[model samples]
Target: MTVEDPLFATPSSEDIERTMDILGENGVSLVHLQFSDIAGGGRTVSIPTALLPRVFRRGFRFDGSAMSGGMRQVEVDLFLMPDPSTLVVLPPLPDRPRRAFIYCWVTRRGGQPFAGDPRTILQKQLNRASAIGLDYRVGIELEFYLYKGESLATASFESPHVSPSYFSDSDVGTALVRDHIVAWTHELGLGVHGAHHETGPGQQEIDLRHLGGIRIADQLNSTRQLIRVIAEQHNMKVTFMAKPFDDAPGSGMHLFQRLLKLDDGTDLLRGEDGADISAIAGHMIAGQIRHASAMSAILNTTVNSYKRLADGHRAPAWATWARVSESSLLRVPSTPEGTLTDIELRSPDPMANPYLAIAVALGAAVDGIEQKLDPPGAFDENLVHYNEEEFARFGVEQLPQTLGEAITNLTHDDTMREILGHFIVDQLLTVKRAEWDAYRRHVSPWEHIQYGEL
Candidate 1:
């Protein structure tokens, strides 16, 4: 299909006009066209609200070579055409002009969608699912740490107790941050379910209601931005790093997903009995399990992400599925009588580009359905405590231990390679491999303390 086909269609003129009118009514003076780079970093360029109409017509151009992930110096020119459907007014900040934000799709000079663009990569996969009359719905639980300053040395709070202070109501600092985040996210139209203190000191979590794939991705990006902005207003810094401290609990972007019938919105994953999973759910879980190892490279994009996947940290270290165990790579959360059911992927972190992460995941699920793949039987018991012999008997496999190993797995996994496409994969590997190499060559305090005198 063409780039402007139903899958990635540009917003209609009427839709753009309506959005412009809404922005005008909201007192928005600047319009920010936002996009995500390959490393999940947010990028933006702002224009006066009056210029948005011209942007919609001609598309904004930039030098992609300046960015980290997608383009090289030789082919530097890239265009960002804002998707007007994503337009939303930013929450007002004191002493700042009211602004609006719209996500953009990366295209070439001639307006063809850039294959290496993370959003386009996701849209392509969404189109694949749409072609089959299915819709992918996703909910994300984002975990992050709030600190007094940008570095650990300047951290404001430190707990002396060995036990975690999960859900504690006493930390007024963190509570205020959470309150602002919830308020701002709601103002931005993200359906905020709840926010609370996590296991680690100064750590927090926010859960957003499930929505369609693209919408959820957009909201996720917006959520991160708002969280950072709100925290800065309070003179605190927030980090979504998978593991910022070696001894503390790591952050994760736990993704809950399900499929629905396009025509009637019937949940395809629901079985006859509420307690049991349907056949389609099984196949999708099987697909996720089959590709879990390779998927880790993208889901856990940073080197520190591997540190969170250890045995006792609640992060899954094995490629296993279970109905209720949080220790498994995939878990089926218990649903109330009338609530929606979905699968939770525990491997992802906030460092991942949400667009690419969800795209590959849905692609795998669709492949599983198409192939009628059967996932391994559920391992209800905690696999972390299982001996190697028991794990072997159950055919459970370990996830890659390091970023290098994960990249190696990604290189060999044909299914994942096909889903993300060779171009995106090549670009990702090039960027990530360089990061791995730099990390390998760096000298750390631990290394110096261990070897300097010895």
Candidate 2:
């Protein structure tokens, strides 16, 4: 099956052979084929070096029933087509010098892209961007929490081991880990823009240079995988859990997105003259606002995600856009000239699939542009302070307060079904419903405390 050369142009067979030769020369013993499930966890299958060639040509088979949301039971043959461009040596598992990791594309029996695959969904959205004669570029700022692995037993998260400082002189106790993160990120060919301690203790942020379309998603997935793997090797446990500790700040995967027109390198997002952004940008923002409730399921894809949406945390409460307001859902950074003016979405947690998150953001923006939707005025004041009257005046609506609520909104939105395929939408709801149902059945410490002996 011949697929278009858009998000991923299948490389020539020679390219694949060349990559294999390099890996062989480097003494890579085992090839770990990796793919992402719907929930963004790394799924892997290891095959011997001897079978690498056959695996590359014919692809390898796996039990679809076992993987999450990617496949269903009843003998559906799934293929793992390795992308040669994603080959990188696993730093954490250096002992297996011959073991390398490569990202795989999930395909069905007749060589069709799996509709439920988040990676493929993002690619489809990028293809949509191409059809509109615009290129979607995304830069990512990834935040994570670092904790002492053994301290989980009895550690007071109220007081962190480190303080918030963008570039303070004091070293965070996890400086070594942060430095290691930088080194490995560079080694893996990601353009490391910067890394520093965030406003919260034990929380660190790493920014990657902007890349066009699917590369942004690829970098995010690979970077997260590398970050966790490296942290584990250092005898520490790292979490991207949105709100891992109650008193601590939540970790967010902020995506900075911009649209560039293909013709003459003109940015469709901003106007040519020295003024406000072009009409396309306005419409895109409008589309995002129109579908805020629906998009929440993808952005905040976990039960714990709602914890960040409440006041005090940086999570966006309203679907407003602003060049100055950081509290807005779509924050336009006011950087100096020549720098890209991008939209910063604060809703996404590090736990969600980066590809799906980006896809949903872009897809909603595309809808707005297509419909020429008008965005409301900027909310300069803190949305948390808005009273019922003020909120009603400004058309401010609160984000989904829980996973179940988000899913309910998503289920009714036709735009979500159009952007994310029906299959994917169904799969996401199915998995998340199971999660919510399981969570409801569990007895919690809070429950016990609330009515222990009333």
The number of clashing residue pairs in each candidate reads 0, 2
Error of 2 at 129 (Å): 0.8
* Tens-digit lDDT track of model 2 for 209-304: 889756777777778877787777766677788887777778888888888886666667765677667778888888888888889999999988
Q: Identify the candidate with maximal lDDT.
A: 1
Full-model lDDT, candidate 2? 0.78
**Candidates' C-alpha lDDT:** 0.86, 0.78
Best by TM-score: 1
Candidate 2: give the clashing pairs.
Answer: 28-98, 29-98
Model 2 lDDT, residue 344, Cα: 76
In TM-score terms, candidate 1 sits at 0.95
Provide C-alpha RMSD values for all models, in order.
2.1, 2.5
What lDDT does candidate 1 reach at residue 85? 78
Number of backbone clashes in candidate 1: 0
Residue 356's C-alpha lDDT in candidate 1?
88
